[model samples]
Structures are given as structure tokens and as C-alpha cells.
Target: MKIAVCGKGGVGKTFFAGSLAGEFVLAGHPVIAIDADSSPNLALTLGLSAEQAKAIVPVAENEELVRLKTGTNYSGVFRLSFTVDDIISRYAVPTPSGASLLVMGTVKAMGSGCACPAHSVVRALMRHLVVERDEVVILDMEAGIEHLGRGTAEHVEILLVVTDANLKSLETAANICRLAQESGIRTIGLVSNRIADDRQEAAVRLFAEQHNLNVIAQLPFDPLVADAGMTGEPLDRSASSAIKAIGELAKKLRGLA
Candidate 1:
């Protein structure tokens, strides 16, 4: 059960990703949550201390760049210094509930080019980790699905693009779906976050139907979520409507009522 959650910035992709992973852990599945979003907030949302998260090395930072002669194969030329286990060990932090987290850090303000070794390394490691790892993987991607170019979408079983009620967010969701299609990602769906009431719910449903996208879940605008973030606490799954809906969505994805 591998899943990738993406959305427009500020639409709650990381929160949904973290909550989904936590719910799976609660349900007794060993899960590996990948923070593929360059913004990097899954750890905080999951209530992990900065020290614990920082101990996990970023994949790109840990990669070794090799300069290959003009004609060398790209894959053969670049070398990864760390073993998969080592990379996992250095980057995955286990929660008390048993879910692990790996942070895929941002490319250093440098544009996307082979010259950016860190980005290249991170991209390569992400491909390997997602495809080879045993545990159920959940990737929390940035708004644009940039990870698609790095082959992260290849291993994903479902790509959930989250959006809010606004027009801009809806447009972004459409764009993400288009990009995912271009990148060969399949099984795309939508999650409408911060839904206010029945009116907003209808709007999202209509939007999804019009766009021919599935609305797997609609999360209510909850102050508790913001409170949890502000206080550096994990969302209380039992009490949060949004979290509960996300959990149910996860179960639906897994076919595990």
C-alpha cells in the first residue's frame, strides 16, 4: 500500500500525509512516511522533536557525486556512498506507534540541473527507497509533483491531490493532475481540505464531478489542527473530524474497512 499525497501549497498535504501514516500505524501496519515535500514539516506535524528529525540525514546531502567521462552511462557514473539500510537508519525515526519517517530535503535554491548533485542524489535515492523498501510507503510531496521527474511517482499506488474551496486551489489541483498524467502517474484522486459546511461540501463534490476526479474525503476546517501545530503536538486522532475522515480514506485505499 504505497501512497503519495500532493497539493497546492497551504492546502494541508503534509498534515494529511502524517495523519494518514499515523492512522495506519494505529491500525497495526508498519509504515514508512516519506517527507518528500521540500518545505519539510512532516516531522513537526507528527510531533517529533527537532533533534530526532535532524538526526535523519537528507538523501541528497548524503549522496556522492562522481564525474563520469563524456560517454559513460549516467546511472553507472554516479555513485551512492550509503547503503539503503544505512540511508534508512540515518533518516528514519520511529514513532512510539511504530511508523518511521524519512525526510527528503529541499534542493538548495539552485535550479534543477545535473550540476546540483544534492538534488540528483536525493532523486536517485528516492526512486530506490520507494521501489525497494518493504514497508507501506507514504510520500508527502510538494504542490507541483516535482518528484515525478525523479521517478518518485513510479512506485505510488495512489496519488491524492488535496485542495481547498477556493478557485486558485482548485486550479492548482487540476494542474497537479495534469502534471501527474504527464509523468505517468496513475490512480489520482482529490481530497478537499478545510471544508466549511454543507454548502462547501456540495461545491467540492460538484467541482470533483465536473473535473472527473474522485473526492475521497472532505476535511472540515478545524481549529484544533492549527492549535496542534502551534503547540507542537500531534493531532488527536480520536477528536479530530479531519483526521478521522483521512483515516477512513486510508482504510478505503487499503480496502480494509
Candidate 2:
């Protein structure tokens, strides 16, 4: 299953993405968790130590690696076609929960008309993983999935836009849904996060029903998740309302594919 989890900032999308990766691995799939967020903390969410996360260099910031892949000597022409197969074994750090993590870092443009080698490497590696590779891939995307362009978006199986009871968050999810649909990513679902009570759950479900979007999951407001984050530990799956809900959501996603 190739899924992209996206949502507005502070909506707990990262937590959901981490849970999804954990669920996939628990199901016996060798998963690749992509930390595409500019400010990444998936390592902590995946139960990796701070030093281990820091050890996995963000591909965008690796100038030497980018130079090697893209041929920095030339201005106009660069190597776009290369193998990133070894990249997984060489760079990916394994989490305690049995998922390989690759921190993509932030891919930002220098200026207009600039041939960003880092961006090139990111795109190439992403294509390799999403299109060429066979493992389960989960991309914890930023508010906007700017890196996974139309070409890349088409190959992805689903884009799960996470939100809460807030109207603005749902609005952002709607906008992201439109963007993904435009890119030919048809299997888009809404994951409602942090519903404190049944009232909030009903409101979120009503909004999702009105929008004609599938409600993949509705996660409760569990303080344990926050505590886990604070402790820099992976969320405990047992009795975790959010994790249980996400496991069901993963089952639903598997059916979709």
C-alpha cells in the first residue's frame, strides 16, 4: 500500500502517519516510512533514538550526495536517471517497530529557474520508491504535497487528508482533496483526529458525509498519545484509541487497493 498522509499543521497528521506505518509493519509488511515534513519528528514517533534520527541525513541537505547523483559540474544538464536501490540499505535507519525510515527533509526552491539538485534527487528517489519498488510506502507529507507532483501522484494508491473538528482544518482537507483529485489521485479519504467526544465525532462525520468523502477513521483525543510524544517514545498500541482506529483504517485502505 502506497499512501500519503497530509493535513494542516498541528492536526496530528504525523502521529497518524506514524501509526499507519506501525500498523503496516505489524501486518508483516516491510514498510518504508518517508518523513517528508520540513521539520521532521517521525523518528521519535517511530521509536528511534534522537541520535539515530539525526544520523539519517536528509537527502535535500546532502550536497555531496546530490552532487554525485546529479552531476554538479554542469549547469543545464544533470543525471536524472540513477539507481537509488542502494540508498535504502545505505541511508534508511530501522525503527524498533520494524519499519525502515528515510528522512526526505524539506525540498525548497532556491529561486526561479534554479536547477535544484536536491529536489531532483528527491523526485528521482521518490519515483524509484513509489513506482519501481514493491514495499509498502507511507509518506508523511507537509500541509501541501508540493513535492509529489502530478506525475508522482498518479502512481500513489491513496492520499489520506487528516483533520479535526475545526472547520478550517476540514476546509484545508477539502482543498487538499481537490488538489489530489486533480492530480489523478482518486482514492482520497478523510481521517478525523482528536475528537474529544461523541458530539465532535458526529460533527466530523457529518461534515465528511456532506463532502462525499470517505471517513477512513475518527481518532479520539487520547492524552497517552501526547504523553508518548513528550517522552519521545513510540505510541503504545494496546488500548490506544488512536492506534486501534488507525489499524481499522489500515484494513480499509488495504481493501481499497
Candidate 3:
């Protein structure tokens, strides 16, 4: 299963993605976690040490390596087609949750129709991950669907739209789901996060119903969730409300798969 976790900024999408990766790994599936955010914190969310996260250089930022994979160093001639099958094997860092992670930094714009060597490499790697790979892949994406190439949108099994109970967050979720639907993505699941009360949960459900969304799960606003990384804890039912919610959502996704 290929899932993309997206929502408004500060919506806790990274937490959701990382938690899902853990659940998948627990279920004995090798997960490839792609942190496609410009500012990636998924590594830490996956409980990687400070040193491990710091040591990882994003594929988009590795200029010399990108040049080797694509014909970008020596000649002006650019190749749109490049093989990145070995990229994950060579570059992915192992997370404590047993998932392999690949950080894809921001792709800068050169010019209209110009071949962006870095962006090309990132896209190629993503294409291979989404279309060719057999294992479950989860992408912690930005609110905008720029990272989800239109050609690979349908290939993704699920586009998880995470949102808080606030109206602004709901508005962003609506817009993202609309754009994804337009892009030929079929399954867009709405995940309500940080619900403070019954009223907030109701609001999120009503908003989803209004937008014709499939509300997959609702995660309560547990203070423990914010403190998950501050202290280490084993993964089990003894976890926090948010973590339990995340685990349930992961199970729901697997059942659907």
C-alpha cells in the first residue's frame, strides 16, 4: 500500500505518518518512509537519535550524487530517464521502528521547462517507490500536492488528509482533497486529529460529511502526544491516546488493503 499523509501545516501529519510506519513494520511489512517535506522532522518522529537524523543528507541536496545518477556533472546534455532502484538501498536510513527513511529536500525552480536535475532525481525516486516497489510506502507530504506527481497520484492507494477540529484546518483539508480528487486520486481519507471534546469531534465529522469525505479516525488531543519524543516509551496499548488512535488507523488501513 502506498499512502500519502497530507494536511495543513502544524496539523501533526508527520506524527501520523511516522506512527503508521511503525504499525506497518510491526505487521512485518518493510516500510519505505519518504519525508518529502521541505522541513523534515519525520526522522525524529520515528524516534531516530539526534545523530542519526543529522547524518542523513537529503537526496535532493546531494549534488554530486545526483549528477552521477543523472547526466548532470560533466555534460550539458540532460537525461530525463534515470534509474533510482538502488537509491533506497544505498541511501535509506534505518529508523528505530524498523522502517527505512529517505529524506527528499525541497526542489528549487530553475526556469520554465528547464530540466531540474535535483527535482528530476527526486521525481524519479518517487516514481520508482510508488509504481515499482512492492512494500508499503508512506509519504509525509506538505499541504500542497506538488510532491505527489500527477502521473503517480492514482498509483497511490490512499491520500490521508489529516486535520484538526478548527475550521481553518478543515478548510485546508477540503481544498487538498478537492485537488487530489481532481488529480484522479480515488481514496481520500479524512483523519481528525487533536479533538479536544465531543463538540470538536462533531464539527470535524460534520465538515467531512459536508465535503463527502471518508472520516477514517479521530484522535483526541492528548498532552502525552506532544510529549511522546521527550521521553521514551514502548509501543503498546499502554501508549497515549494519540498514539493509540494512530495505531488503530494503521490497522484500519491494513484491513482496507
lDDT of 2 by residue, 1-257 (tens): 78999999999998889889999899888899999899998887888888877777898888888878778466777786777778788888889868899998875522334456788788778878888789999999888766786467789889999999999998899888888888887688888999999889888888887887777778889888978778766566797988988998888888887
lDDT of all predictions, in order shown? Answer: 0.74, 0.84, 0.84
Each candidate structure's TM-score, on Cα atoms with residue i matched to residue i, is 0.84, 0.92, 0.92
TM-score attained by model 3:
0.92
lDDT of 1 by residue, 35-105 (tens): 87776878866767777766666655554321321123664454444334455675577765467887777
Kindly report the root-mean-square deviation of model 3 from the true structure over all alpha carbons: 2.3
RMSD of each: 4.4, 2.2, 2.3
Q: How many clashes would you count in candidate 3?
A: 0
- For candidate 3, which ten residues in a row score worst on lDDT? 107-116
Worst 10 residues of 2 by lDDT: 107-116
lDDT of 3 by residue, 17-89 (tens): 9988988899899999999998998998787876788889999999887888777445676778878998988
Better of 1 and 3 by lDDT: 3
What's the residue-level lDDT of 168 in candidate 3?
96
Tell me the number of clashing residue pairs for each predicted model.
Answer: 0, 0, 0
